[model samples]
Target: MSRIPPIKITPIKLIIPAMFALTLFPVFYKIEAQDLKLPQCQDEEIVNTVVDFFISESVWSAYGESKIKEMINSSIHTANLTLKNSCVPMRRQSGKLYQVDMTIQAFDPDLASYRNQLLRVTEPTIIKEITQKPNHYYALVVDDLPDDILGKTDVYLDPQFLILSDQAEKYTLEHELGHLANAWHDDTSWNSSLSKYLEEYTPDAHKNELHAYARGYNCAGRRTIMSQSSVYYLQLPIYSSPDIFFGDETCGDHEHADNARQLREYARRLKDKMKNNV
Candidate 1:
């Protein structure tokens, strides 16, 4: 070949950029799942579970290779650690299973991953269309969710915050899932009649700042997976029997069962809810 200029590295590098100007090959770098960080949760093993009862291979596949890898990377980078002033747990009576209709569209590659996850997770449950009859077994998801929620429950995301913000994403995902899983606020119904001191100190409007500590402490002890101290793995796992099935296992052990501090925190929430009229 006529003097093939010694492999021109600089020119070669420019060639791709130059080519992109004329050609349309949407190129993107591959993101590795290892790059992300997840904190060592209270119960590490339980937190890592992706059991058949929960998200299985089929479900994982739907997350799309790139997106799944990205979510993992983000987690790795941030190291899913606990945030102070963060915790949410609600209580709802046990009932028959219900289906949730979570129809969401992806506006970006990352957003798409979360939407896909929602579609996949609810697969085992019946997806019924909107009709006149009331549906105890299904829910209607109307919008796209944020990133941390990628493998978790999907919910309407607020525009004020970035979907990828670890704190926001995790909190939002857990809160919505609380509703999806039918968990109610530990507030339950407060006994308005209870001494102003009791209501004021509890997680109630009647409660004043003095009891705020007490309110939160009691809420911590209810022992539901939905407790404020839970990590993704500790949240509700899929119950295999059927959509409507609820048994002994349906109830989840406290994610922080070993952590006496968190357990006491939960107790406050529980007490407030059990308060008559509370």
Candidate 2:
């Protein structure tokens, strides 16, 4: 009988490169709900809403899964308060609930680079995706966001994704969600005009440097969640009402009331669209 060559067994060391490639190249990794250990809430309706959690390998390596989950849970609780109190009721009247589908990804190379990619390359795709569907939103949580912006929502270009910094405060997520729901900046009309004029007139390279001055001079001084000023007033008590202008009655402004009306109208429009799709 002819000698048969022993079959070669691949060394484990040789296989590692392929494994590493597989791990590095995948677009995203799904995180199971059990892994999150999500904080329980009394309201089953809010709890029932699906949340799809995702984290980049880089983020997981840096923050660890536990820390990431903790941060996300905290944000979710804040968001739930806003949604349950404010958004859901309006949505329910239309025979539909406000459903949120959020995807959080970590930036590679650097957070700033990712921000540039979002603004330049991916924004169009994101806008198309969100407009084609209803009740879907995306958020990117990163170690660093633009120095001037703690959180921002571009409703026209990328309504799905809000860029949030890691150091974002308790109400920041809720504030960005307000934008996703069609709420404009607390002082959008006046502040935008003034800011634009300053940008045109000022020769300084740093345009946002004068933003605070512009806001102070022209803003209506609202205390709503959408206000740029609200971040400074975190001492105010939280309320369990559907109004975006719920806290600090003394600081209320007509803009807050207008925003509430806008929110309701936005919800009604979403409901009508959902009905039409069906």
Best by TM-score: 2
Candidates in order, TM-scores: namely 0.22, 0.51
Clashes of each: 46, 1
lDDT of 1 at 138: 22
Candidate 2 structure lDDT = 0.40
Q: Tens digits of per-residue lDDT for model 2 on 31-57?
A: 222221111223322212222222333
| Tens digits of per-residue lDDT for model 1, 135-159 | 1112122223332332233212311
lDDT, candidate 1, residue 209? 22
